[model samples]
Target: MRPELEPGHVAVVTGGARGIGLAVVEALGARGVGVLCVDHPDADTSAFVAACEAAGVAHAVASLDVRDRDAVRAGVATAADLGPVAYAVNCAGVDGLHPASGMTADEWRRVVQVDLDGVMFACQAEHDLLAGRGGSIVNIASMSGHVVNRGVTHAAYSAAKAGVIHLGRSLAVEWAPLGIRVNSVSPGYTMTAMTATNPPEVNAGFAAQTPMGRLAEVEEVAEPVVFLLGRRASFVTGTDLLVDGGFTAW
Candidate 1:
């Protein structure tokens, strides 16, 4: 673990209750970084609490909707209460698969609001908290942002994720002088609570599309995210790390 991620430092992770977000929280905790796990109001925090206890790190859970700017600001403020917030992972996102032609305005807005706008809101709040102290931020994007999925018809999801990837780059430049680094991680098809609910054939198709011949584990995505959040990636900013098992390469 890098010194930047050591004890006495804290992190704020949105969507920390499950999936890739939970994995990032666990990874940060293992590095002795106190964590503030922020998830939706109704998200279950049992797993997050267990991970923190096992790692023996100071921890708190905030029920926050990343779509709300005020709520996101308050969440970051709460994390600061734990310790010096050195890192943040914006993992709160949603995906809606609907063909563009038939997609209702409401459906498109819902996905964009949660995926792109939510990430922006969190980044804004995080930037304010770490303005002078220097910190790193990782936003969770998707391979869909780089390439269209073969059998999926989710134009809105793809567009939002693309926005997230670019947003990180734009902020990285703006915040660099302030000592804050911003980056994004784009994961390929991954095994998660939500994807686990899909039919076997559906998952198999996703795996078949990838050169790796398998979906990514949540840990795989979290590892790169943690890397970008630490000093190891000190010179790495204004970029998107693709943790997609070469899914985008093909």
Candidate 2:
């Protein structure tokens, strides 16, 4: 049987408004876990939370930019008021897919900032929240971190995800003493708002290339994330779990 999370234990999920992050929130919330939905100021999380309210779990929404360290810290504090933030997942990022040649310096910075630096800022801010509780941290990476995609080119996105993997490993080593486990999850072509932006040709191509011959559902990717955030993964850290449909293997 799978281990169950305790009640009143809260989690912080960046980009919790939709996609894989939204799925994670719903999963954990259904298990009686309080969660803080942290997303960009422009993201309208109000409706998402209203829908989740039917699940009968406590939740909060923080409209803060991950690039701002101070705002991240404040969000952590706000979440702590609800309950101990026993789990945190940095899922806020953009699929900055553009040809390397046409990708301007600003575009590169934006991708790196959200994908890499955002994860760092979140973990740093949560240090105090997870210190005594000895919780879990999961950084959302991508299969692009391991293998380059054929149709899409996102040098910054891939590089930053690669950095996210290493960042979790490095932090796992340092935070182990504090009983904080840090790990990463990489997904290939999953059905989410991010992938919905792609053209039909691009989506079809991704499906054909996957060994599974299909794209993954959001819940499929969120399950492993929940596992890593729970007691089941108590001894697991510093590892990258590929939730890809054998995309990297192929």
Candidate 3:
């Protein structure tokens, strides 16, 4: 296990209250790493709090929107109180389903703000926390960034995620001298609360398109994130790992 992943070291995970973010928190807790969960003010964190207690790991919650720069900085500072902050995962994001032709400016801005801008704000704050101490940062991007989904029309989401993938590479270069490695994980269709709400046939279509013939599990995506955040990936940086069940293989 990486020293950064061992017990006593803290990690800040945005969108930690649910979905992939929550899964990452669980994975980190199982590794004995403290987690500072940053989510929207209105997000329900009961489950997140319970998981942390069940895992018996040090945990804290910062209820603030990631789009706000000052709020993100304060959230990272809050995580610093637990111990040495060594890792961070930015997973707070929103999807835009509207087609590019009919997408309004506000609609486009909303998705880009939360998906791309949010990641940037979180990264900036996390960088400050781990600057001299050295650490790892993983931004949760999507395979949508790589290829357009067969039946989906989310231009904004795809654009924002594409930005995230490159953003990690750019930051990795600039921060390497400071000992901070940056990377991204792109997941295929995953069964989460949001996806679970979709019609069964809708999900089946997703499965049919993937070479793996199935959607990815939340845990499946979480493990790679843990690996990237640990010492095992010590020399790995400026890359994007696709945990997409071979969705892009074809």
RMSD of each: 1.1, 1.3, 1.1
User: Candidate 2 residues 18-96, lDDT tens each?
Assistant: 9899988888877888888889999989655964686677789889999888999888678888877799888999988
* Model 1 Cα shift for residue 29 (angstroms): 0.8
Which portions of model 1 show Cα errors greater than 4 Å? 1-4
Candidate 3 — worst ten consecutive residues by lDDT sum? 1-10
lDDT ranking of the models: 3, 1, 2
Query: TM-score for all predictions?
Result: 0.97, 0.96, 0.98
Query: After TM-score superposition, what is the CA distance of residue 131 in candidate 2 from its true location, in Å?
Result: 0.5
The local lDDT score (0 to 100) that residue 114 gets in candidate 1 is: 93
Root-mean-square deviation of candidate 3:
1.1
What TM-score does prediction 3 earn?
Answer: 0.98
Worst 10-residue lDDT window, candidate 1: 1-10
Alpha carbon lDDT of residue 249, candidate 3? 92
